[model samples]
Target: MLTFDIENFPGYPQGIGGPEMMVQLREQAERFGLEVHDKNVEKVDVSNRPFSKSGLKEKNISLRP
Candidate 1:
């Protein structure tokens, strides 16, 4: 599990704890069917390959090195 210290975020006058903030964020994202992964993406290839939905050039991506 990844943890973050969110003392700098707004709405917490006294600064919210790290674990608590992570839990709240995770729950909110879950409500929208978002899946969070803990793996580190070590590499990315951004070479021009295809056009995106907006008709702009985009790159094919590969996460692993």
Candidate 2:
């Protein structure tokens, strides 16, 4: 699972933000047969074994066996 903590800190020449970068990265990952989530992550809980992650517009998944 790839979690991106993107922030617009004035590096891009065009009008792009963190969200846009995330989309580009997801597309690249998909080319490599990786499953990309459609919704953006809102919160994450990694304190426990089954690391919990919540999405902004959909149910999240627990990375565990």
| Per-prediction TM-score to the true structure, in the order listed | 0.46, 0.39
Which 10-residue window in model 2 sums to the lowest lDDT? 1-10
On a 0 to 100 scale, what is the lDDT of residue 27 in model 2?
A: 86
Clashing pairs in 2: none
lDDT string for model 2 (1-65, tens) is: 25344344466555455566777768887898786555678888889979878877677787552
What lDDT tens digits, residue by residue, belong to model 1 across residues 1-52? 2545555668887787788887888999889877665544444444543421
Superposition-based RMSD of candidate 1 using all C-alpha atoms, in angstroms = 9.0
Native-referenced Cα lDDT, model 2: 0.69
Local distance difference test, per candidate? 0.57, 0.69
Model 1 segments more than 4 A misplaced? 1-8, 46-65
